[model samples]
Target: MIYLDSAATSLQKPPAVARACSYAISHYASPGRGGHKPAMDAAAAAFACREAAARLFQVPKPEQVVFTNNATHGLNIAIKALVRPGGTVVISGYEHNAVTRPLHAIPDVTVRVAAGQLFRPEETVEAFRKALTPEVTAAVFTHVSNVFGMILPIQELARLCRERGVPFILDASQSAGCLPVHLEELGAAFIAMPGHKGLYGPQGTGLLLCGQTPPPLLEGGTGSESIRQEMPDFLPDRLEAGTHNIAGVAGLLEGLRFVEKQGVQSIGSHERALTVQMGEALAQLPGVEVFRSKDPSQQAGVLSFRVSGMDCEELGEALGRRDIALRSGLHCAPLAHRTAGTLETGTVRASVSAFNVPQEIPRFVRELRQILSEKP
Candidate 1:
């Protein structure tokens, strides 16, 4: 199948990722709990994965990186750790429901929303500057919107937040491995990302990287201190609780290795080139209208559009019948669609991968044109 849902989750991960996971399962052992060889081996593997993630994300200390089940859990930890009750939080309109719902659930939290599609670097900086009252403790936004692949000016916003002493948090599920991120350069306090997405790892793997000073989200057994009932107030052990996703972590480590070898810019350029080709082709097709960031520099690997006179669901199904996989509806970013003027019916989202080739774009566009011309 010609899979076009990489933004949702990448398929056909690097061979090393699968191999690492299989090794984890076959040579099973509990990490940080046992003294045997198997346990030691498992622990070593887990630590290596953490170190790899830390190195990739540019965290100073390996222990500062906390592994979560997925980006949702990581986001929850980030929101809970920084956003106290009765504090103001600013979130972009482009955030995923993973971020928006969690912020909404925080009692006494006041959310100030801004335009998702129209947000440029300068506007984002201004928003942070205007919202940095003493009462505003934190701000959350996405580096890239999963809906239309719009890339926000995160570094500029991060700098603004740094100056104002407001903790800047990023939900980077769509941009993690697809874009370059150095924790030091961005100056963000918290970053939540799914390892499965651009990281090319298996599902159920995710991580949260925090600045030099980060709050603890959960208190539990760290295996280092079984004697303490309360959680330790330090680094990853302070946040990561219970058994970890060892298999998934194994896969993620290999994924990082693959990315490191291939280079992030290369992956990003490849994905963008493919998306641009697809978007241009789609725009040229009859009865098709594409929704994308006008500026190519401000977009990611995803593209959303609609065919005139066809429901989104029908178009997605039609595309699927032709061996193409695409996502329809809100894409967990209703606010983004609202900003893009596509919320009422949603749009058909085609998210390309670094692995997608040049030939696939023309084929996808030709099939789309054919499908749109047919009667429902």
Candidate 2:
């Protein structure tokens, strides 16, 4: 099968990731839960995983890295920690439901969307500049759109937040392993990413990088402060209040190491090259509508398009039956579709990964064309 849904979750992982997970599952116990060799090894492995993530993301200290079930879990923690009740919060138009839902649940909070044109970074910056007023309490922005793969002007938006003293939270769910994300350089108060996407880890693994003390999403025994009723107020132990997913952490550690070894820029380039190849071919097919940027620098590896008179999900189902795996519909980010004016009919999303070969693009395009031709 030809897998092209890395934006949702990477199906092609480095062999080491699976091996590391299997090894940990068999030999390791919960970190800090006991005094046995298994527990000790688990604790050591968790810290080492943090160190690997720190080195790759340029996080100053390993303690700043907090592991959670997935990017949504990390995002919820960050959003709650930063946003206050009845305060105005600014967000980009391309945020996933992981972000919007939490904000909606908050009482009396005003959500002002900086709805910029797709693939227009300058327009995005301007939109943010206008929305990021002194009264705005904080800002949340996605590093890349899952639907359109439009790379937001994060640095500029971050600068805007800094100038106005608004706390910035980066939803790096799509850009974490696909681009260079220096914690200190960006100066974001919080950054969240899933380990399962470009990081190539298994599902149910994610990281939240903190620049300051964040309120715990849950309060429970951290195994460090057994005597205290209150949770410990440290970097990781404060946020992490449950048993460690030792096996998942081992897999994620290998994934981080793989990204570092291959280099983020190198992997991103490979994926984007595949994107360009597929995009060029798709643009040639009659009755196909391609969503892309004239400036390739403003885009990433994801391609969104639609065929005339074809339902996006129907097309996706057809492609799936042909053994070509991709995603369709809103991708849980309806804000992105509304912003891009594709809310009525969501586009087909084919997101490339580092493991995809150049030769695969032609076959995909050919299959896509055949599918369209078969369409009534």
Candidate 3:
């Protein structure tokens, strides 16, 4: 089957990822829990994984890389750490519920949406500039839009936050392994990413890069500071409670190595090329509303569109029958759909990964053409 739903989770992964997970699960013990060889091995693997992630993302040290269940978990940590009740937080209009819902749950919090048109970086940055007041407690933004693959001007946005003294939290769920995210350069208070998505690791694995100390979300056995009533004031121990996932860490380490070996720029270029191939052809179809940018640099590896007189899910079902795997609907970011003006009937999203070849785009376009005809 042709898999194009990588923005959600990468179906294709390096062989080493699975092998590492299997080996670790069978042979490892709880990290830092015991003095046995298995426990020592787990500790080494966990630390190595931290070092790898820290180096890849240009973080200052390995300790700052904290593992969580997913990006949502890390985002929760960042939001809960920096944001207080009744404080104001600024966010992008294209944020997924992962970012919006947490803020909504906060009591009396004011949210300023930096609403911008798709592929319009200047406008998005301008909107953010207007929203980021000195009084705002923090600003949260996603590096890329999962639905449309629009790459926000995060550098400018980050700069704006720094100048305004606003703590910045980044959701790198869609950009982590697909694009370069220099944590040191961005200097965000926290950056969250799921290993399953662009990192090509197993699900339930995530990384949270920290620029500042994070408050503990869960406090339990951290294999250190035992018999202490309060959580250790360190980074990982403070945030990571309970036994670590040795298997997931092994898989994630291999995934991180694969990403580092291939290089983010190379992978991103290949994915963007496939996206452009799909977008340019789909835009020509009569009655098809394809969201594309004249400048390829404005978008990443996702192409979103819908045919007239057809619901996006219906189109997706037809493609599913044809053995083309993709997703349709809001992609869990209804705010993005509303901003793109595709909320009434959501757009079908085709997200490419590094493993997708040049040949797959034409086949997808051909299949889409077939589906459009039946709908018409």
Off by over 4 Å in 3: none
RMSD of each: 1.6, 0.8, 0.9
Which sequence of candidate numbers ranks them by lDDT, best first?
Answer: 3, 2, 1
Candidate 3 residue-wise lDDT at 53: 98
Per-residue lDDT for 1-376 in model 2, tens only?
Answer: 9999999999999999999999999999999899999999999999999999999888999999999999999999999998889989999999999999999999999999998889888888998889988789989999999999989989999998988899989998889887989889989899999999989998999999999888899999799978999888898999998887889999999999999999999988887787888888999999999998887777889999998899999999999998899999999999999999999999999998889999888888889989988877
Query: Least accurate stretch of 10 residues (summed lDDT) in model 3?
Result: 367-376
Estimate, for each residue in 1-376, the C-alpha lDDT of model 1 and write its tens digit: 7899999999978998999999999885778888998888888988888898888889888887888889998888888878877778988778789988888888888988755345365666676667667778788989988988888888777877787788888888999887988777788888889989899999999988888445656666778777888777777778877887788888999998888888888899988888888888888887888876567777889998987788999889989999999899888888888777888889999998778898988888878878867766
Candidate 1 TM-score over all chains jointly: 0.96
Point out the worst 10-residue segment of candidate 1 by lDDT: 114-123
Q: After superposition, how far is residue 120 of candidate 1 from its true place, in Å?
A: 4.1
In terms of lDDT, model 3 sits at 0.92
lDDT of each: 0.83, 0.92, 0.92
Clashes of 2: 0
- Tens digits of per-residue lDDT for model 3, 152-212: 9999999999899999999999999878999999879999999998898999999999999
Model 1 residue runs over 4 Å out of place are 212-219
Any runs in candidate 2 off by more than 4 Å, and if so which? none
